[model samples]
Target: MQPSGTPSRRVSAFDIALALGGLLFIFLSAQNAGPAIAALRADGVQGTFTAQRLDCVEHPGHEQCSWVGDFRSDDAAVVREGIGFYGSERSTFTPGATSPAFDTGRLGHVYGPGGSNEWVIIAALLLVGLALTLRPLLRLRRPPRTPAPPPVPEHLP
Candidate 1:
């Protein structure tokens, strides 16, 4: 007879793939935490927010996504610039608006206390995801066991 109550789920390929992807994100983010903290400590120039763009394109042959923003540097005369690669964010900065430059005072203000705490939060969430993903596989390893019936009493018969 089938077990009553909740049914066990079979681990599928998609679950493994998703777990791997989540793990990859956690790993990558963990690796960058140190550097990010360092960068947060470093001094940076002030800039005014000029514009922000999140451009994405998809085609049969290729796909591309670009995230960038223009900031007006304040150290000197008016100059438009942006940063990328290791420190990049999807933002919405309107032209003529003044806002803190990302790598500089903005990050510290937004993240609060050097910005390292967020990484720990991300790791914890990913760990929960990892456990959920492994649950199905772990369940599959232990098959349900049925109890053997007791021997009939000869006297009763």
Candidate 2:
């Protein structure tokens, strides 16, 4: 509270730290966006065909969904069990049965925080962090909107 009866405002250290953390993702995503996109578009053949929908058994702390099938291509040979992560929506494979390959080529796999979608998610986080950070700063700068005191009427003689 101020002497003028209005509340004072300041951006807290905790808020600043959180904002910085969130904003960092944006920069990080930008750094990875180019490479992730390129790898996804590169000459990769569908690694799995005649695929089967593999869901992790009802277990906590597991992703629980992916495709498992054999890898077949001119560059590769011999049927091998392959599993894909976080690609359920793109998969056409059904549980316990084989299906045509949904992917045209093998995926260019990256270690972590890779793929175009992850970039989008990071960007969203950055924007949210920016908003969270900026809101308090803006409030501090804005003048308090307290109403003016009413004028007193003069007494009649």
Candidate 3:
């Protein structure tokens, strides 16, 4: 018979390792989720800016006013004008004409960082963590699975 008051070594090293792994999964899931959300948010913001905003620029002595989305700013004057009004602008002017290198209107409304892909990855990781954490706990509480008792050995006559 076992002595009284001695602690039973019930938990195995494997179980503890699994718990640690599960925690790692939880941490990783959160980490991955963050960047994904940021990307999607950025995309959303860019989309909104693209759809809902406009820029305008005025050049000195220019015959016609060049507006945002106009041909593009090739000359320093047009570049300055764009910066004056829009706060910042990127332009690419080739021999023929100038054009915005980037669309600020589209850049302002991004909403997600990583989007659905990150969401799925994080969710799966979280689920894995939950499963890992629960499985051992459940097994620990469960009664020992044993075969039905065999008939008692025949007693001495």
Candidate 4:
């Protein structure tokens, strides 16, 4: 007779395959789709904005052009701007006193502080860590087994 309350052993290959496929999709999506999605969301933000595209007028640089964008509302105004990569050392732009202070900090770089390559490296590391942590969780399948085979008689009449 089977135990009164114990659950039966059930392992389905279909279920496992479905789960693995989902995990793979998630991993690939995080790697390839995350940045584009993030940019889309940022662009969706509602606020008064100004943007300008600039190129290195002075000297050659790693980056060709930079985009400066700012967001503003009744409550506050925030600047979302960065310098593009240039082959030269660095460039700075100073608007007049009437204008809000918006500095790119450095040239030949994305977002003024660090370059696009830096962000890419950081994002890649984060994804790697996420995958390592989630892989076991996604791959979890079975619990420990306790059942044993019954004894067989040596001689049969």
Candidate 5:
């Protein structure tokens, strides 16, 4: 390297941390992405969820609700207990009511006849993770900037 004025790009601990955090996000999102997509596609055990109870959590402005129940496959071959019916609302079901559902083997929750839009959030997380992971590496690839020519000195008469 004959050039002495070029600024060097060094990978700092912060960059490593960012990359590691990004990998964690990517891993967590990927773990759920497949099941979420499958649930959206209704590609899993077709079943009916029997509402045993409605669980609600009150928030500042509104309440969130989920129907906790049992899911039984149409053929009666598969049955799961105490699983949540995803996207169930207060008016959607009452005690002892049943709705068609799909179980993509995701624990504790199943999809209803109408698939959910969870994949969108998962995709966003993946994009954010990818950006975080690549940002620093990309910075390192750019040509080093030449140091601004030493600030022009004022000439005195």
Candidate 6:
């Protein structure tokens, strides 16, 4: 607790660090959110992804997989090579097979026709960041209390 008569709580290095970290998280969320939202809405260049191969990585208990492919827009205006199809699974596509996809200018990956839940994670990050940033400042807004008066002594024995 702060001593009486102090105007406000002193800000600490930890508080500053927390706020900075929160800002970093907020910045990261903002940076990725646009592309993620666009991809989730399929609001970009409509294209077809031709699967060239399946790239799989084995973890301790499971395997993560994606289809590496080339994308060509329906209008033939946009074409991307060596891009991975987002949310692809092991059996999602066969070699040389094509699937409808959307390119929202996110590096290295294109979204599929079925939308993704990526925005949920980004929203959560943003909320947590806001909370962290505000928690330290909230203490400073509270008014300080005056010291209480001493109790009177007994008058009679």
Best by lDDT: 5
Q: What is the number of backbone collisions in each predicted candidate, taken in the order shown?
A: 0, 6, 31, 8, 0, 0
For model 1, residues 44-132, the per-residue Cα lDDT tens digits are: 44444444455556889986654445555566554445532122234433334444553443321222123234445555765766675
Tens-digit lDDT track of model 6 for 1-157: 4465455568788988999989988998999999889977879899899999999999999999999999999999999999999999989999999989989999999989986778999999999898889878886777666567798887995
Please report, in order, the local distance difference test score of every candidate based on alpha carbons: 0.50, 0.53, 0.45, 0.40, 0.90, 0.89
Q: Write the per-residue lDDT of candidate 3 for residues 17-109, one digit (tens) a residue.
A: 888899899888876666555543433222111211234345786433222323122232221222211222333122233322322232222
Better of 4 and 6 by TM-score: 6
Candidate 5 C-alpha lDDT tens digits along 9-40: 88889988998888988998999999989977
Evaluated against the true structure, the overall lDDT of model 3 is: 0.45
For model 2, what is the C-alpha lDDT against the true structure? 0.53
The residue pairs found clashing in candidate 2 are 44-105, 44-106, 45-105, 45-106, 46-104, 46-105
Ranking by lDDT: 5, 6, 2, 1, 3, 4
C-alpha lDDT of residue 27 in model 3:
86
Count of clashes in candidate 3: 31
**lDDT at 69, model 4:** 40
The count of backbone overlaps in candidate 4 is 8
Ranking by TM-score: 5, 6, 2, 3, 1, 4
RMSD of each predicted structure: 9.9, 6.9, 15.3, 12.7, 2.2, 3.3
Q: Which has the greatest TM-score?
A: 5
Task: State every prediction's TM-score relative to the real structure.
Answer: 0.36, 0.46, 0.44, 0.25, 0.90, 0.85
Return the number of clashes found in candidate 5.
0
Residue range 1-157, candidate 4, lDDT tens digits: 2476445544367655555665665565566454433333332222333334444444555444333444343246433443232222223432211112222222322222221233454456556656655555555545545567788869977
Model 1 TM-score is 0.36
Of the two candidates 2 and 6, the one with more favorable TM-score, higher being better, is 6
Poorly placed runs, candidate 2 (over 4 Å): 1-8, 17-21, 24-53, 57-64, 69-82, 89-91, 94-120, 150-157
